[model samples]
Target: MVSDRIRILFNRIAPVYDQLNTWLSLGQHRIWKQMAVKWSGATVGDSCLDVCCGSGDLALLLAEQVGLPGHVTGLDFATAQLAIAAQRAQARYPKPPLTWLEGDALALPFPDNHFDAITMGYGLRNVTDIPGSLKELYRVLKPSAKAAILDFHRPSNAQIRTLQQWYLEAIVVPAAKQFGLTEEYAYIAPSLDRFPTGTEQITLARQAGFATATHYPIAGGTMGVLVVMKG
Candidate 1:
């Protein structure tokens, strides 16, 4: 299903994934991702993990924020994406202390309570086992650490939901086609459709043993950020 399709799509588009993201979001994704990092309350010396770290955008940003004293690990299952991420990391910031690992979200290859903060951008919905992935995230995050998840939202309001659907179905897919990524982009709507809404994600976070779970709807609820604090 989506799990297989996503793996294939990302592997194929890894080289151009970051460029497509900027074009797709009109460069606003950077702002949204930065906001997600800021909302996590990550400090200068925090150890951070960026799961499903496509092209290492969030990882690089977190590394810059944490400075040389802190550690940042970006994990992704796709080798192609990881290659691109490594190239970008080396080209712009040579000798960065950040680590990029090829790993799965369901079973992270890290010790328990290892990371001070964990962030996932537009990735949770694609996980085959959403709840299981959340549990793994909670297990690795240290007590009082924050996990921020940012992804496309299914708007609860009727009018806004309709518009969001139109944008995804009509605009996004078509635009991606022009960029020679129509097949890859076609997965967007279905993925978002299967993803939980803001409220449901908050509840899932709580069920996964998060002490404090909060949801923020951005861009008029067309996208959402779920912030969960580990106990």
Candidate 2:
């Protein structure tokens, strides 16, 4: 039910998703996404997966990183978002080595050890089952491969945590109000409250079979990237 709600929310905001992201993050999401891709160790000719690849931002970056002989798959549950991603890819390349699919993150439609690298941007928090999603990610990644998951976090510092809450209520929600997405955007605060902390995420990743896992805090702990390597 949570996944269904999130899917509906994403689909409703698909038209203004890119614009809102740029505004909300002050255009820094691009940099964060790139960081995630780099941490994944994706290289030229290495197949990659970008889960919850909203609007194909990470997937497009992965495509550039793994060019020519390499391939990238962008998977998300929202059809509207995937449609926009496909259109963007078509406009950007004559034949981009990218595939867009409408699929669930908990049950990836891929074989074990299929991808050289994987990246997930702002997706882990919304999954109905975090461990299941991580296990699925581990199952699909090649042995010795890595996955970098980027997401917003509740700052451990009291002051910064208050600031984050204020920003979401005052800035983010109001901005979404302009697009009639106030309700959808308001869920972010509650979701962040329920999301696992970086330390907890590392533990979850290891439990899911990753041999090595590290959570790198970013933006003063307001965000983080969990890098996990499959053994």
Candidate 3:
């Protein structure tokens, strides 16, 4: 499946993933990730999971927010990504003890109703089965737990779509090319096209058995966060 291609592309780009993210987002990605974590409703003592935690940006933030009494797990399918995450976690302090695991998003290894909250950034679009991934997310979170999934959105407005395309080509591709990951980064446009819209994400979340779900658009509609709560 083409999902395998996405996995491979991520592996190829893993080394520069964090840097490129900062560059491409004009350093706004960090704030966006924090917003997702905040929307997850995780607290200082809450156990949390960051699924598809590429290079562990969101995971690291979770670690910081959850404090020492909490546990934070950063799970990704790519060892290259997880390795960087592990390295970063080692130097961080006063944060939750972080665990970096190489695992599939579709079939998480955690027990049922295990985590108090969950956050995922820039990963929902690449999943092979969106609904299946949501189901897995639902299965792992405790009752009344919250989750926030942040990702790119295909802007519906023609002007915004044009601007997105221009930025992708002019900024994202050029920056990625500097790291020799142009091919890897080029998949974004197509991926965004295939990604479900904000409204659709809420529909899928509800169908996956979440008690509450809302889609929040951000950055002039080029991105969104799907906030869901398990009942």
Candidate 4:
């Protein structure tokens, strides 16, 4: 079960989460998410689902890519985050054929084989049952559909790992404080530490019934993208 404390913490910090993320990653988070979206191979007229969509960044991007004929659903458990995402969607895209729903990742409210493609950005780490969540994603995605996940990874190289630690602890925390989100930012390192590595995530994807899985390292292995396709 997801701890109440973590949910409350995220709801409380939702407003500033996107801003803090940009600061913490020096605005690289957007690039990483965009890369994941591109790797998903979603095309025009494809229906896409973005679980743990957060502020709807990937959802909007995918919607834009899929055009007016396609549909995009952005789902998250945090109301505050969803509210912000709704407001942004209204202000920016106006009538974007996109739906924003407040929901859970492990128990998606969709029927089996519903979506053409699915993407999760910086969300797998926050899930309490990563494998279970992957299975749920697979269940909702149509046969032959693709799923792309982007998240932080523990660097394998000793020197790069050390540098990553320094970057998160030193730069991220302080930058977050500037945005009045020090406590929220402090969660980054520990969360990444607790998260499975890229290789492990690939294995999980396969175990979850993905026909094929691939991992792409970015930022010198500090971040990773896992792409999985259903048989």
Badly placed stretches (over 4 Å) of model 4 are none
Candidate 1: stretches off by over 4 Å:
none
Report the C-alpha lDDT of model 3 over 1-231, residue by residue, as the tens digit. Answer: 776777788888888888778877889999899999999998898899999998888988887788888889999998888888888877766444798898899999989999999999988899999999999999999999999999998787889989999999888888888888888888888788889999999999999999999999899989999999999
Best by TM-score: 2
| Residues 174-196 of candidate 1: C-alpha lDDT, one tens digit per residue | 88887798988888888888999
The TM-score between candidate 2 and the true structure equals: 0.98
TM-score for each model? 0.96, 0.98, 0.96, 0.95
**Which residue pairs clash in candidate 4?**
none
Candidate 4 residue 103 Cα shift, in angstroms, is 0.7
Expressed as tens digits, the lDDT of each residue in 156-222 for candidate 4 is 9999999999998889888878867788778889989899888899899999999999999899999
lDDT of 3: 0.90
Better of 2 and 3 by TM-score: 2
Model 4 TM-score (2 dp): 0.95
* Poorest 10 consecutive residues by lDDT, candidate 2: 87-96
Pick out the ten consecutive residues of candidate 3 with the lowest summed lDDT: 88-97
> What is candidate 3's TM-score against the reference?
0.96
Alpha-carbon deviation at 103 in model 3, angstroms = 0.5
**Clashes within 3 Å, all models in order:** 0, 0, 0, 0
Task: List the candidate numbers ranked by TM-score, top first.
Answer: 2, 3, 1, 4
Q: Is candidate 1 or candidate 2 better by lDDT?
A: 2
Candidate 4 shows a clash count of: 0
